[model samples]
Target: MNTQATPSPQFYLTAPAVCPYLPGEMERKVFTHLVGPRAAEMNDLLTQGGFRRSQNIAYRPACESCRACISVRILVNEFKPARTMRRVLAANSDIVGTMHPAQPSTEQFSLFRRYLDDRHQKGGMSDMSALDYAIMVEDTHVNTRIIEYRKRVPGAGIGDQPKGELMAVALSDLMSDGLSMVYSFFNPLLDRRSLGTFMILDHINRTRTLGLPHVYLGYWVKGSEKMHYKTRYQPQEHLTPRGWERYAEDGGV
Candidate 1:
């Protein structure tokens, strides 16, 4: 057996706050800062333990008396597209996503602004400016990348990569076992494309291409309509008191 030493990271708990997903419920988090040389390894460990990254912070739900938030990740190798998902893939065939080092751009911020305005006007990130957006994308020590989606030009030939108008963006983490979707946004005008679902689908395909077995989709809360879509990806695993196990489709909240 090979032996390697890694420093232990300190953890903290946040004060309880109003639950964003479930009404009439309070939510709290146990979080740790991801920094220094071992940030990447620490991040991977925490993520596998059900923590999610936001900029340089890794956090997981630590609510009192509530176990509604379940960490979910897709089993990519075992996934099969449903009829509706296939249709979504075909509908977005004209779009392409290019992965790049995590960096902020005016175009990306513009789309992010529109998406926030249209979908989450009164949410926590509504007041974020361009600089804050930049920090969100770049202030990280772990392996992070952004995938920018755009529509292909009419005359563009095969193997010709072009960066057109930005349509959607996914901020993802390349972990040891899978790609974790930290956050994502899309052009509000292209709701017809269902860019949200398309982004997840694209990540699944990307994971397959990379020979990764899973795609981390973050947490799913029971009784939250906003989180219901996450359960659509079948053969997924959820972190439990025992450990990660296959999620039951009919598993009640």
Candidate 2:
């Protein structure tokens, strides 16, 4: 009979670094490795506790003086697309996303490079090589998936695979309670299509279809312009000192 007890995860704190979302501020993170047979279970628990996964590590903000980085998750069943969101969906009607195992491809890397060059040329990931990108997608210990978004080819049968131009890709972790979006990128040329917002809407729909209750959207930093979009998705819950509570734009509740 197996009677050995499982080892608990050891957490580590990252050194303070310049805040990416806010100016004149520093950010720190508390993290732990997610590996072995309990990886998936640990991921779900850690995520529900407000941690965000990157590769095999689960981390959350450990800033000393700031609590602006609030974890946000959409209430999938109660989500109602606003007119603007509905417009985004209609704009991306021709694009379809297909889920596959978390495997990287040359084509995806190419698109990723373009996205970084155009949108995040000065960001930390700007210098990531193809190998680095592959590791990001494939080095997961939990249930991860890569969803490829492409334009639907005309006359394509239901069984036919999408062969049109790749528009975007999403790397996500499927948790027991919800889907956690780890990373996503899109073709910069299609900026007018608002592919980023479309991807989030798609994930919300996917979560609903899977009978999941939430679509984890990672952190929404207050005062961060880059994070403003996350707040557009109404009826979401934000992790607070009290716990996950419904967020009211009017500042009630």
Candidate 3:
């Protein structure tokens, strides 16, 4: 006894290009635009279907003969911290993250510039200007937010919140199942913070606090060092042809 109308989504495939994660390998993607009045609802469905949103575009791997880009999500309640992850948490104890509207800021762009210059100097987005960065943050049709991380300012009291110069930023999407971290960057000079891992751990904790199920990490390429960290979030599931299947720790079928 249910009557409802579901919106239809149109899909497109991108031309093959060099894979960012795996060198020499080609990458192709099946993508669709997330727009119109039903954008949020459509986003929820697309995410569940293994697509990740970037700005207003939702995309997933569509390689000719490779399936390495597996969509992953941590089962938050079941995630237990490993020894190394505990160390990372301890290392970043002085950093506090504040979630805000997805509106971009000049300070964030400055941090973004430093990060790109230090880390991804030769990557595709290396040439992006402040305007491009702003569009990446603000050009969205679905529910999105930005989490700003900063050093905890020395509070003269115990209960006071931290307020310091911006150290990192993560543009995230609010999905029904969990939050999807669209993109993130930090002050590359602060390499000691292990900010990348710290952010993921923080998001996992945030999801748990929100009583959500998973944190949809975009993709994990098996042999990619940059993506290998994603596998450490145990009790995670991967999107396979069958469905979201639990990842085997032994790296087997």
In terms of lDDT, the best-performing candidate is 2
Candidate 1 displacement at residue 117 in angstroms: 0.4
User: Per-residue lDDT for 97 in model 3?
Assistant: 90
Q: How many times do residue backbones clash in model 2? A: 0
TM-score of each predicted structure versus truth: 0.95, 0.96, 0.93
Q: lDDT per residue, candidate 1, 1-253, as tens digits? A: 2112236677778899999988899999997788888989988888889999999889999999799989999999999988999989999999989999999999999999999999998999999999999999999999999999999888888778855778899999998888999999998988788899999999999999999998999999888999999999988999998889998688832
Where is model 1 more than 4 Å wrong at Cα?
A: 1-6, 251-253
Q: What digit string (tens of lDDT, one per residue) describes model 3 on residues 63-130?
A: 99788888888899999889988999999888889899999989999999999999899999999999
| Better-scoring candidate (lDDT), 1 or 2 | 2
Winner by TM-score: 2
Q: Model 2 reaches what TM-score against the true structure?
A: 0.96
Q: Rate the local accuracy (lDDT) of all candidates.
A: 0.91, 0.93, 0.88
lDDT of 3: 0.88
- Can you write out model 2's per-residue Cα lDDT over 153-221, one digit (the tens) per residue? 999987889999998999999999889999999999987899999999999999999999999999999
Q: Which residue pairs collide, candidate 1?
A: none
The whole-model C-alpha lDDT of candidate 2 against the native structure comes to: 0.93
* 85 Cα displacement, candidate 3 (Å): 1.2
